[model samples]
Target: MVDLNAALRPADAGSLQPTAARPPARLQIADVSLQYGGKTPTLAIDNVSLEVANNEFCVIVGPSGCGKSSLLYLVAGLTDVTSGTIRVDGRPVHEPGSDRGMVFQGYTLFPWLTVRSNVEFGPRRKGLPKAEYRAIADHFLEEVGLTAFADSYPAALSGGMKQRVAIARALANDPSALLMDEPFGALDSQTRTVMQKLLLRVWEHTQKTVLFVTHDIDEAILLGDRVVVMTARPGKIKAEVPVPFARPRSISLVLEPEFIALKKRILGLLHDEIDETH
Candidate 1:
């Protein structure tokens, strides 16, 4: 069977391998509810409570408009919750800040900035000492394997490289949590696959808590420690299935009996919703 519990985790310096630490309580969504400008507020998300253990890679997947991204914006505090609470390390999330870094689908890197400059943007905003922030930027750029392109402008790199720069920028600040909103949704299959491997390696090294939102089931099953499925707008948790797969996962594994089993299981769970959406 696909081993779900073998997700990439933080590693120690002595060996470039995942080293377990006290589980980080990276993000908590406790009975949160929200909606847009509708007078009734439409209840876009209803009482969603989720716990992402420290450094865990949790993926939220569902059909389009299922409030997956809404849940992310709430956790990142880009929008306020109507009723419940969102806590990161026991503190309420009221507004956006550097503690949580966000990577959007579009490669939002400044076209005019060099790779180093883009990664350095956040720490520079924090007004740290020049040398310190520069070092931080250099480190993350290298971590994401973009060191050779440190001086290249966003316009010069391929789509995959641009995303790597974006990821480096987010990690430069060393945020405890990373929120990705369909970050790989636009890439061609080959580039997307390459980027996926790059991300797992980065996570293996950094161990940052990740809350990923995607509509792709294969991507979710391949990358997440646990997959949380949601229903359509006025979204509610439809299923919360822990991914039972092994790490260093690959496309080849998807054809395996265990991987096929989990895929069927999740698809079966979503069959009703998919049909209803038609």
Candidate 2:
């Protein structure tokens, strides 16, 4: 019998301990709320606050329509918050900027662009020297194991391959934080698992701050330093469960007893929120 409560304890600041010269949070959200205005205003997110440390990987999970994706969009500056603030590296986010890179569930790649071209889009847009941007694209393409497909168009690649290009494209921009919203939601189980491993490898190498949104509890645990659970619609922070596992994690971690205990605990939390809604 594992102590589920103990397993879900808040993460110790072991690796994240701040010093006098430490930088501000890489990503910060304070009292964020999003309400769609109309005859009947609908509040999607309510007073949700979160902070992601530099190089930390945080994942948000919740039931359907819980505004998990909405919160991520607010951070990406794709939608305005009704009230509150979102900051990246101590600067407020007003609109989409090069400082943040977004990857959606859909491939969202330009069909006409080849894999290398798609990855170079951001650097090219920033007026980087063609040679420099091409090098950047080549580097990330290799990182995601897409070097062989560099010249293949998005139409020529499979779903998993397209997403690898999408990730490579996001990282090429060299954003302060990587924001992903269910980026693997469209893939089959086997492909999703492979992408998960690939992403972990790239993330370990880049060490970029990440805020990923997903409903999959297994993924949230496997990929995040902290798993933030949101309440039902009109989402609010339900809990933050720190992952106790050590890094350089492999798929086999999922088979361990500790991982199973944590999953059950988080699943229970989600079930409670769901029950309240009905």
Candidate 3:
């Protein structure tokens, strides 16, 4: 382990370069909490903290009404955190900004706009030149395998296809973080599986930081680099599980014994949390 004399020789100026430490976390949620207002207020989330490394796929899984989506909204800057902070690259998140993109469970595409136009919407609003937005939309459409459908309206596309457009639209913005809230939860099992694989492909290609929320344990395990499990309503992080599987994962990997074991563990904890909520 000691080659200090050789290291000190450094004869080639072109070959020697200092290596810096890895950058700080790309997204950080520090002691965040939230509440819904009314005469009788409801606490939706409680003292949650988590981090996603740059270009990591981090999934949050929990039982129904666990406030997973609520936390996502806070990160997206669509809602305010009652306490603590949400930061991206060390900048505090206060309001919706172009730095983040969102894909939701429902297909949030504009029925009136064509697929390409829908993807172009964000850049257009930012007043980027037409050619630039056109290229941006086209590139992401191709990435999502939707290039051929670029001219079609949302009303004419299948649910899966429309969601693909939603993903493409989000990515077209070149956001630093991609926030997803059960984006495929509504699809049938078969379609959902296909969408999951497609999403992995796009994720590999783009390498953008992702924070995805899902109640599906299988879905969580299939995609996350690390899975953060939350307690039932008034949710707080109950556990954090790192998925040790290699990347470019496939649906078949779900059948592996190791995968099954991890799923069982997460499911056991999640089931306990659900029972506690009841």
Candidate 4:
């Protein structure tokens, strides 16, 4: 929690602003469903309701064919929901915009643009003055440890570095939320580990709300404030497990007795869900 007493502002100088002290559920999904063409008609998701509080690190994990990525798309408004509602900051999500920054697993950085240019893309599209772009882009790049290679092309960087640049680009605009769909799924094992550390550091430095979609159980447990496990197909949330560990956790946290116990429980929950789905 931010120390309100130490935070200075002109309004606080003279009067008190009446605001509820809650992280606030910035993203809310209620009885949502998605349908697509298939012989059996893939439901994608059904009756799924979730709320992500401000600053919460939420990870959605399930089996391979589950609708995790579909859920992210629905949140982004990249695809329309078949039913129910999606809201962010208490407003219904209707279309894609910079209010929510998204990082895809495929590393969508423009091959034509340099890393610096890629990071600046969002700010530039906003028509933010060039004077402001440098600092915003540079700041996030530095956070991702890409300041030295700001001018390097994405093709020239390692897989991990490329993903970091993508993250910096998403964060440069300082969006109210970050939506990620398995953003590190394409990397090598070592690179994925490094990227996970980078993601934690970035989340620490900039406490934007994150909703990450991953199929990896270990990854979900390692990063999520709350891990939402869903059923295999026609997905539905099966369990929501709070990590219960404090922030700045180490990789060794996985080996901790409590962490291991929770992991086993979550696995059993997911197993039951998977069987029901199949």
Each prediction's TM-score versus the true structure = 0.88, 0.94, 0.90, 0.89
Error of 2 at 83 (Å): 0.2
TM-score quality measure for candidate 1 = 0.88
In terms of lDDT, the best-performing candidate is 2
Q: Evaluated with TM-score, which candidate comes out highest?
A: 2
The clash numbers for all candidates, in the given order, read: 9, 0, 0, 0
173-263 per-residue lDDT for model 3 (tens digits): 8899999999998999999999999999999999999999988888998998878888888888877766777888989988887778778
The CA lDDT at 43 in model 1 is 70
**What is the C-alpha local distance difference test score of each model?**
0.81, 0.90, 0.86, 0.82
lDDT of 4 by residue, 104-146 (tens): 9987899999899999999999899998998889898889998
Clashes of 3: 0
Ranking by TM-score: 2, 3, 4, 1
Candidate 4 contains a number of clashing pairs equal to: 0
